[model samples]
Target chain A: MTGTVWDRGEPRLAGPDTALRAELRTAAQHASGNVPVAVATDTAGQVLEGMRGRAFDSAAVVAVLDGDRLRGLVTLERLLAAPAATPLGEIMDDAPPVVAPSTAQERAAWLAVQHAEPTLAVVDDAGRFAGLVAAPTLLGVLLEEHDEDMARLGGFLGTAATARSSTTEPVLRRLSHRLPWLLLGLAGALLAAVIVGSFEEQLGQEVLIAYFVPGVVYMADAVGTQTEALVIRGLSLGIGVRRIAVREVVTGVLLGAFLGGLALPLVWALWGRADVAVAVALALLAASSIASLIALALPWLFHRFGKDPAFGSGPLATVIQDVLTVAIYLLVATAVVL
Target chain B: MTGTVWDRGEPRLAGPDTALRAELRTAAQHASGNVPVAVATDTAGQVLEGMRGRAFDSAAVVAVLDGDRLRGLVTLERLLAAPAATPLGEIMDDAPPVVAPSTAQERAAWLAVQHAEPTLAVVDDAGRFAGLVAAPTLLGVLLEEHDEDMARLGGFLGTAATARSSTTEPVLRRLSHRLPWLLLGLAGALLAAVIVGSFEEQLGQEVLIAYFVPGVVYMADAVGTQTEALVIRGLSLGIGVRRIAVREVVTGVLLGAFLGGLALPLVWALWGRADVAVAVALALLAASSIASLIALALPWLFHRFGKDPAFGSGPLATVIQDVLTVAIYLLVATAVVL
Candidate 1:
């Protein structure tokens, strides 16, 4: 027998609210209450008769409710395949995957994917059924988030619309999307110039030290970029930076050592200046090792502050890495060469 | 009256092939042919009875077939709402979104999303029904492709598996994923060093030029990275580079002019050298403008060769931008400052 089944009049589906849709992009915002619902004791034939004239946002699955609470879910396929006299409760999935209405849109979509459920159920704090996030909405969220992440990682303002319009967007709109990040990058670039200017004395004495600046900065950025991509993807999948920080930093150091070992002899053989070679190799080691740390740390900070972690990957993080790489390269050059 | 219909005996579904699944991830590879299928003339009651005893990979949508040829599709909700004697042809949607079995998985998923359909039908070259790609499979494909794009854009070897395993992956395995690109980056870096070395005479005469090397290179890489991300996302969305090339290059030049205008006065005031400032500003303009051209071209070449265009975004493009920036900076400095 079904436990505590209470009928609450007719099953009225929730309708879209344009005002609420304009708010935070949460599960509650996207969850549509327009799906079909049935009472547990209803026979398949009875439910089918009731559904005949009603419109549903999604009819793939039906929520079986006991009063105001969700009891289980039954896919329409199951309902069609069952005997006409079979009770809804007998064919319903009693433990379908459910999330609170406050869940992040990406997290909600991810849970649906992990559960391999076509639609996700959203329940309220008081354990009342809110609605279901249908397949199309879930698909839209995934694509939108993908576009946003790529835009943020590429240094464009994080707008889902930007990704779609970027190809055909007028040059002015494209500039508006790309300029904010580049301006920030320019400030960091000037700061890098200041840092190098402070090291002009050493460079004036040993002009060879200047030759490796671009090389060193480029290598560190390459290493840091790899870490940023890994961390961003991991974070979106519900893995935190703290979980992978140690291993990632270690990978950075090992990579530095490998690259440095190769560079030391190569620079010495090509340039025939052992001190310059040592400085360049050592700078590569330090810059590469620190690159991953900064990469992981910036995203972690952004995540902690409730910003998109992907914002830490592109222009902002690149500038930070460039400044630090220049400082490390010069500080090491001054130490080893002069 | 319904169009010409042929009967092809029993509706047997295609089974998974392990060998084929290991090859190129395509629509055919992930599609499940085990979905429910019914002839157009079958009654709702008859189709329901036929589906009762059979197993289906996905029962969300039933293919309405004319023999082996697809006639239409019917969601379970419509079938459930119909009278028992209602022929499926009356309820079936004759124009459901569909793709060839050889279509790319991403394209198939996009079609499903565009059509707002939970499932996609796949047909063979000769137009026989091949399978239905279920919602879950489409969701998985989106997530997998997202991870792969992030990995490739972040400069990790382009492997979908690498994105999932990177967080918990052992350090050695991590190195394997990261080193191939870093080695290529190192070669590029050393080449940058050679480019800088060729400018040693200019640097010794005016050591101030060395101060802007990191700054200029960083800015160009930042600009180039934005275009790369835009181009990569655009390419995946089926927008070819040629469509956006003129507008993108124009945006790049405009961005360069804007950044250059800002840098010129600031450098002159900070360093009190108009020649060095002019060189820096002009280099900024030239480097920033060329960055987008290289960014768009590399990815276009990769796409033309049937490679994943995401590869053109990260270390490869960055190094090319860096080398060119350095050469442009010194060339401008020699022309203006000397």
Candidate 2:
């Protein structure tokens, strides 16, 4: 037996020669009871009739092949609106989305994102039909990478199939998969601690400054995450959303202006230092909102570069946002308050 | 002649029947040269022969239906190791993921984050297949809601599709859709800033304390953003992670420790106060990391609670993190410097 490279410990590929019809027949022949029906395709005429009479739902699709060569497919959905006299080709979407064998998993994921479809047309290196990949499968890869433990958490699903693949990974494997990320996070924390301590004289001068640290950081994080989420969601859903990506910046600016409006008064009210509040809020709001726009900009850039946007999260967005945020904060404080 | 009530501005439906097949044909007809291939079900033998011959790109899938109801679907990727003679019913995965009509745009956007092959089988009210929704269409809805005024500034997609619907409407519609959320954030920011600023007397007692505010806040934001990015990405990917949402908290603690270590060394090196440096670094690291974790944790919590995680970002995460961060910073400063 060949060693299967499993995704989430479930075999992702069976073998090239696997056939469902024969397997089903054999399963039916070998065992008894509750045999599933064979799904078939419908021609345009048949589909139309089915729809006209409202039986299209019962119809599946089949490829009307000529011997062993080329042919078109017929499905009830396409058939319903298809003219009774029209041939399958005339009504068929002649060119379909295709995937190649040499295509990287990430590439397939890119196709899934670009086509805005959950599935892709998979072809071999020779441009031959290989197999199709659905969006969920691609998503599964991401989830598997996210948490060895989340596979057990059932991440927004109720199915045993996905559940099994997600949750069945052994503890050791799960730990191995996730531990590195946690360790990296630990390292990041250390770096941050050092930066803060290095500036102790500055902090020691202002105890009140310490109280705002968590809130400012949290706010910036929230802004960055939200902006990133929006842009990514936009990118994932709309393949050519470079236009939307830019708009995110504008939205961020507006959000900053609005947030600044609220933050300024409150900061002043809380500290009874109107000048400090105005200065800090103006800078903070601008940083927070703009950070989100910048954070969200990556998905489009990654796509333009033929990279996977979903794979990046904690590594860059956080670091960049933090550095810029600090610069803006200090600058604003110096220019306005100091 | 009828409008597409569901999307509001879909290209005109080509025909009358609202049935899935009819609707798809209508869209296809309207699209003409732009019409892509139609994806439909294929019997087991057809699938085998197709793959063996390298026919169509494995972009299309074979959906298994039981009397108009979706049983499961098989994609090209699934066929690689599948038995050559199996019936699709035997191999088809039943209970595939689905999307309901009433699902929010944000939720739909989030769902698009699946890494595996994912498809949303649009079903009619009867739970029968209506049509397939590609991810782009869903994301387009949100992008369309975005504000765009200038081409260079990202106001439009530069596609003629916008001509189909009056831009004035979506913009106006957004006022209602987005204003409330912005207001909520504003209120939160205002309230927090006011409460915090009221402590001006304490800060005035030590003007130096104000100088550290910006630096400490930026550190927290940086950590929080990273955490938020991870969680957002994980959720979008459908990773079954659960404990990590909480377990991630440990990331802050560990980070704090590292930062504290550095802070102690740096402080002693810079100011010749080993104890103050050590204490402040420890305090800053702990507070900073905690702020980062909270920034991340809150969005997931909001998403889990059925709110848009994007909407969850702006005020709440920052306000809460800052509040806690400030308290921590104040405590540390008073204990050591005051």
Candidate 3:
């Protein structure tokens, strides 16, 4: 009778001022309309029953009491739903859910669900009920919140360009969408092979470099990723400062040391030369330590600067780490093997 | 009287039922404290008087209406704050905010706010007022919520490593904690300059390459990120399989076209050389588009494989994008410049 329930499947009230026993009348009206409801107070039960199964007159008054105030609401359905013999002392709720009158319509909708309420009782400074907010208003608010979250994410990444052309594709149609491009990796290696063919004299003299390439590349990547993983996790969790600074840093050092130590023996076995082993060990230790730090720092920086922390996590880290890793490897190779 | 408010400003409901109303007292003895609340019917004046100047009893009850089964609840502080002259009808907020029984205790603490009325109400189905959840219980729940949110974020990111050391300074410790990091893009750029110093010779030989460096690296990064972002967002939001694959791929293609056009002109201006511009333009266009599409595809693959989308977002994007960008650039340069 109040209205349809698109708002959150909750009932609605007219406003703050109903005459005494207003609730009772509201219930009776509903019952006449074929919906049964339990009246809260024993005081209002009889008047509702008196007109049992009959349509309630809107102007008809009913005697009622709920806790301390008198309400003008009365409905036949409410009367039918209540236990016929229950005492008035046993049937009323104490406090009702409410919101401020000035509350945004959208926010009000979310509150109904998050706060788990039916009608949002509007109130004033002294906590007096001013009016009621319907459920549909609250639903609108929830949808708006969702939209805002999406917007922030879109802006942080480059969504506009992506949306424009390949509005249907995943991101952008570039070298990757086609199978021809997948062969590019093979192409790069094939080119590398051709380049080495021209430098056959040098490569033949230093054939061991090939064995070191995979380890060096993989190690650099692993260290970089491990660090990135840590930093991103820290920012998202709101981890305490103490842990981020002290504990996280200590962990990076320990991990670097472990990795450095593990790779030293392998490097020595591969080249069987002290110079090569020392260079590999030193590079591994230094790069691992630095990469871990950068990974952690990058995310923290992004979060601190209001940049997208996720942005700090992936491509940037790899760009800096890989480039540096490759350069470091080349430098050490020059220092030792050359 | 119940306990006073806590530091965080939430009302405190202390141990056990004492000084509570009759319905609450009865439910406590009979319902074994499992029920949500108890109800009673009275005038607004009586309801106010019962709650006036005194805290609601610890064993307070949630309330509902016998009239139309509307819900309302009260709490101890609300009762104490209630004005004697106020009518219950104007203040009865039938639907009190409620939480799941299993909610964290810490979060529950702050959640207990009494706009009006005395006794936090707890209720169950069939429109019955069970018993009060009590302020103290809620406070405990609130504490638990904070911890839970932290743990959940960690799990979502899917890692537990906290960085303990860095190759250089602990960037998060030195900077992130005090403020944000991305805002210092200038500083990040300067730091990048220091990194580039280690490879200045390589950069100077092909200054044209320098102009295209940012454009190339960023474009590849943008493409990869766009793809990942869309796929991840879709999976998280629970998009259908068809929608994700079709929508994301199309989006990537569009994004690539837009970026490629911009990069082509920029590289042409920077290099001022016909062949270099054409080669760089082709490379940028291809890499940008492909990187984005690949990035987009990975998220769906991750979901299909039951891996996290955000997991590989950072390190993976950087590596694939950088390697391809660098290799392509070098190859294209060889094909044209040489």
Candidate 4:
């Protein structure tokens, strides 16, 4: 049981597991390899004496190792409370939460929070103790991830620093960070204009049909935004769109039916045009149902391509939802009013 | 020198500081009063022995107090490293990060992260020691705030739990959380329709004006959404909207001019209608410039009223911006194109 060697170099790998090391950014990258370690057979007093003059990245928890393999973990409090001769093996938590080095940082941090652990242990593919991610590092990661998500969702060009500096940033720098998305949105807006213009003759025949274009487009966009928020957040927490698609789409349709049902009578009462009202209601139902699909699919596609799902929730998704909504609304209106 | 009182009740106040304690929900509410405490003159050996059988909410940092007043702080590692007979005062950090008990939880957490402290000390108004907010509690607070911001920005009725459960929640429960905002959006959309209908005569004369409605509205919404994201995030980090307003509005106006200049020539080339193109470009300029103002103002107002600034970024802001954008676009078109 006293086979542990106090080596500070990288954990010696038993085999080359390239697939597990392929992730460019992972828990291993941020973990510190300088935490305290001891053998299971060491008594509490012995470990404490060993730690006295040694430097460690974190001493909140001590890792018990067999050669290079991680065996168990014991918090400092537990060690200090035990009798001087108590063996670490008898006092250690055998089932401490552990993650592979390849795990995503966000997922690792989430696991630490779930387990209420102050530190996270990274185990390599061969079960060797790699390092520990201390609480401060995890806190920084959570804050950084939150800022990145906000920037992406807010249509910045994937710059987390912008969230803090945008308020004080030079106008030119601010414009540069924000213009790419707005330009793409400009292109999308022009495309929506072209789509709406193709139906100019229909609009000229009965002008009331044009009145609901913004209303229908806004509803679809609103519904899609809610779904995008959910899907993006879910993806970050390791929940895939595939797992949520069925329920979300159902919720979208149900929302559509409810809004459309309310809109039909309300439009009839206010606008005094039954056909136009019917068209608006039908378009609401179709546009909203499709909005959910587009919202779910875009994030899923981005995630599949190894991009942040947050990128899918920006102006790009809104533009897509807007154009489709316009086409669906007009098509429904044309069929109903003509 | 062992004059420390080991009372576990609330810190004995020296005077009534009711004004400082008036906040309904603050750091004091979540702070644990069960943390370890010691006096400056106590020896490290004596303190360690005293902590042997104690049950503390957190022992990561010991609060040094003089009667009820907090004096300094010392980490457990430092205590362990000091010679057994060394006075705690000689080893303690004279300055530790502290917050008034009435401080906002987010701000307190931010300070903790800024100082790289594993724990936060809460000092009551009479300079009395309240307790410590441990690392785990701060982690929980940051995650909760992130969820709440996402839900509010996503238009989910201020429910942070919706972020996690929206994927698995029943359709009815999902709808209940989401529909209130959508319904408000519907009302605003209808109001926009009515506003656009008011310009029906102008639209009938030059039907092209109606084609650019969604384009103008979308661009304004996009711009406003960016500003809202920045301001709301800034507000959470304790930066007031007033501090960000000037630069943000300038950025908005600059964004508008750039987009408007680009659109002018493009719309003219595509539609070949000089007056209609001018109206679209001008409306883009005015709507975007105004979008920044409304976006900045709404969040600031909500924050001033003691509500989360995130509440202002949802459908409520979108609807306001949409209606105003439509009216401005159509009004400009009525003057230029009609």
Candidate 5:
């Protein structure tokens, strides 16, 4: 039920080793070569007869080959729409999006999605036609990629393995999958404590300073998360980080100003401390703007370091945001409230 | 570049109204009825001839109809593999997953993914065939749904509207989109401050108690976020909340115990205060466990209310976790140290 239930072409079994490796080629498998093929000179009538004589597994798109080299592709829809006497060359999409057989499965799926094609043609290094990746295989790749991204963002140990595992997979397995990030978070937590401890004198001067620590950190994290989500999805959809940098930063500052404005009055009304309110408002403005910038920069940094952008989304980014927020909040409290 | 580049059947122009509404029929555009459909009584050979006469935009799946009454579907793959003399009735998939035209677009996409089908047949109330939803349409829907889910989790204003807008969308527009959640977060932040203020008497008794507030809150939020990601993806994959509830809870507790165990000694060593250490560790364990429960329950509650489960993921969950983490940390610190 784990893998075969959604079997398009690959039988993805739920096992410990099902974790997709970082290699782009790991996702691409050899196609069955069962799709219908025709020579460039074949007439629609001749292609129709050839199609009838053979038991091809998929003929959604007929590959037009010149001996071993693919020249073009003709969707079955086009073939059916054409007069039987028309030559295949006249109706074929001559410039179909072709990819190397070793291309990352995710990229291959993206190419198909970008072109809105249900089938993709794979070519070998020498420009020889390998086979067609059917719609199901492409769909499976898309779904798997989606799961992997979500898993990375969730801080799972291995996305493909854990996502495939039944809910009842061993507790030990769950622990092993989750502990790495939680441990990283633990280190961040300790650092937060130390940072808070450094401001002990300031905190002692004004007990109200501690009241807003969690609030500021949470808000920064929230703002940062929105940026992370946008950047991750945008990068995948072909929008580069450099394209939206200015707009995102400006949005961050504006968001800070608006949220801080609302927060200032509420804190003052509730606490009756003008200094504390000012400190809270200042911290909010600073932390929020910084959080948005960090959110955009981290994913871009991960991408530059040859990592998935999602690697920067979860605990790692949140920890950094928390530390900065804590420092900003306390420093402002020291200057304004103390 | 609007729709032709992605050439999925619909030409999705980048517009302010692209956010998919809650209706399913919005995504179900009229299929050009140009796909090669046939009556169940027609022979494959006859259907092939009939297909040659019409201009089909897609023939990946041939609808077997009886005077507009939907009979079954025969994939082009299977048709290619069958003897041409065979009748459509003998080769058709009789039990295709059919949805009403009004079914939610996301749900329709899910049904297609779960069934591993490339084409979906939309049937009317009396079971009359509307038309075929081709593979490109299904792929588009999946990608859109993916974007929308990510946007909601990231706390975006309107997924379709904002995600499609170039990151260069006006700062005012960006502010408008983000301010709603940030505003919601501001209210939560003020409430957190008030919660902390109520415990000021206890905090004054031990100044060191304030150091762990941000750390504790940050760690619980990290854990809760992991759970929220899993539950959101899990629910979409057809895993019911009840099935994984117990396992998730146990995993959360075990995570809490392990992290808290490590943190206890570390805090004690750093601060030379066993009482403070014990208080921090106890709060971590309790808050971590509670965080997981809240994470799971919030999405479930939203799902129960007929809302998108992702609505429970970002700021709302974080805000709730923050308030509770602050309360628990201070209460534990007061009990242990004071």
Candidate 6:
């Protein structure tokens, strides 16, 4: 329960545990069926008399059904305002949104919110009434999904599983949860060293070339992280990667040019080496442009594979940017300065 | 609306724009006053009659008002099942959760969700009923706030404001939104170079020292980012930084030791230099521990200042960790290798 709380909430509708292709049937399990219901032909007097004999869970809305098929819905307020002799059909909202059990849970929630309905009707494949997803459950799912997205982007493996437990979980459990990504980071760090070692001759000839290694990598990472954040969020909001691809590429190049343009003068003034400054500027330009593309592509690729797009963000992306930036900086430096 | 789309909703009750110190009065703006009301002495029939005459904004529940004082709340479902002659005072929920106008909006939302109430009642400082915040508005605010948190953590300067526009924003607008942070990153990159420049002698004496710069800094940033994400999220969930401080410190040390342990033998095996390997390991240990502390402290400090805790995450935290990591690596390298 401590490590796997999300699975307890109705597997398919629950946020973090939801598969990439989860549907409304999974979410319907979380819906509350404990509501008042009446036959579509029932009059207000008959419904009121039946209601008096039965205990209700949440009486926010009363469903009017024809056999097992949902016919209409009557909000408690509307029901109360109706005269006793009025038939339920005369006052019920005949067009309340109904979702098939196979609909995507996110789409279902979106539709519910857009219609300003506190509850959503879930119907079976044959259009029979299934149940209602109450406002509280939808709110919980939305909030849980938000947390899961952030956790995935943050690159913590078990952190999403233990999200609620993070605050009060024991220290050992916290350590255990965060260690998986840090271990992956270790492998990336080693690869970064191997990449730098490939340019050892350049470093030996001009030691100053090594000084800007962190600078170039950090800038590239800064730019990349921004794009990854944007892309991940955009994907969740239903915007496709192709829509923002061109603008991001242009921004990346422009950002690179502007940042590199400023750094050229600064490096030249500080180091008194024109070749080194040129190398730094060119590397920055290359790294920035490459980082943005990588950031955009990684998330898009993950999504294309039916994975959470957030899986492509955070430490994994940062390490990839770092290795590339170092290789780019050293290669450009060796060519220009050595 | 182009830049300040968030303001289109009520200023105070909306999510992202709320200041850290914001109180209940702001959230009350989202509350609807269009509910059936009775003087507590009125019967269900009178309340029902009154409800039918008005155009209600939200009819989830009825507020029993006794001379502007919130006497009790009668949910629509409860009212429907009650006999017409039952007095409002006898059938209403006498102790529904009520908050003063100064209650924090987030707290109010939490209370509403916890109580499974579709709306929240806000009372003034002197206990007069302000209004009832409907479910739709609260749900919208929560989702908006969640998006803002993610945007801030992702390091895009105007991304939170332009969240909905990220996919569709023009190239220039995207550049403008991202440049402010990248500019700050540029400054930090320059400082990282300066820090590396200060270690010129050690790097010149042994060029291999420069090879691990990116590796060490990258690892530190990776570690720091995990802490930053955790601290930012924890703060938002009302978990105080001090509560998790000790565990985080210990976790950082353990993680550093583990990563450094694995790294030491690898560096020695690849480079065949024990001094260099030892320096790398020790530097990793020191940098990792320091990065974790900085990550935890920055977000806590930002939150304490009534600023968004997310401001302490992303590129800002990463850059700060980079500077310290580089400084720590070189200082240890100079001591061990030279």
Best DockQ goes to which candidate? 4
Report backbone clashes per prediction: 0, 91, 144, 0, 1, 1
Clashing residue pairs, backbone N/CA/C < 3 A, model 1: none
lDDT of 4 by residue, A1-338 (tens): 33232436554333454554453356887787777788899988777666653446677788998887888888876876788788899999888878887777887877788788888888988788888777777777777777777888788888537356766777888899889999999999999999999999999998898899999999998999899888878887788898889999999999999999999999999999899889988998888899999989998998887777889896888999999999889988988898
Computed on C-alphas against the true complex, the DockQ of each candidate is 0.60, 0.10, 0.04, 0.62, 0.49, 0.42
Residues A54-170 of candidate 5 have per-residue lDDT tens digits of: 565567788888877889988877776678788889999998878766666666767787788878887766787777878776776767667767777777754437344634466
Report the C-alpha lDDT of model 4 over B79-124, residue by residue, as the tens digit: 7677778888998887898988777787787778878888889887
Order of the predicted models by DockQ, top scorer first = 4, 1, 5, 6, 2, 3
Give the clashing pairs for model 5. B34-B56
Q: TM-score: which candidate is best?
A: 4
Candidate 3, position A100, lDDT: 46
What ranking emerges by lDDT with the best candidate at the front? 4, 1, 5, 6, 2, 3
**C-alpha lDDT of all candidate models, in order:** 0.82, 0.43, 0.40, 0.82, 0.76, 0.75
For candidate 3, the TM-score of chain A alone versus the native chain A is 0.44
lDDT for each residue of candidate 6 in A1-338, tens digit (9 for 90 to 100): 01100111221232343453352224466555666777666776566555542334455667788877889887765665677677889988889977765554554665667677777777776777777776666666666666666777676773356344665577677677778887887778888888888887778888888889999999999889888888877776567889899988888899999999999999999989999899999999999999999999988998788777778888778788888888888889999997
DockQ of 4: 0.62
What value does DockQ give for candidate 6?
0.42
Docking class of 2: incorrect
Fraction of true contacts kept, per model? 0.72, 0.10, 0.02, 0.59, 0.71, 0.58
Error of 2 at B141 (Å): 15
Two-way DockQ contest, 5 vs 6, winner: 5
What TM-score does each prediction get for chain A alone?
Answer: 0.87, 0.57, 0.44, 0.93, 0.82, 0.76
TM-score of chain B only, all predictions?
A: 0.87, 0.55, 0.42, 0.92, 0.82, 0.80
The candidate with the higher DockQ, 3 or 6, is 6
Per-residue alpha-carbon lDDT of model 6 for B1-338, expressed as tens digits? 01100101221232353444352224565665555556677877666555542445566678888776888888766776688778889988888878765554555666676677767787776777777776666666666666667777777773436455765788887887788888899889989999999988878888888888889998898778778777766766567789889988888888888888988999999889999999999998998899999998888888778777788888788889999899999999889998
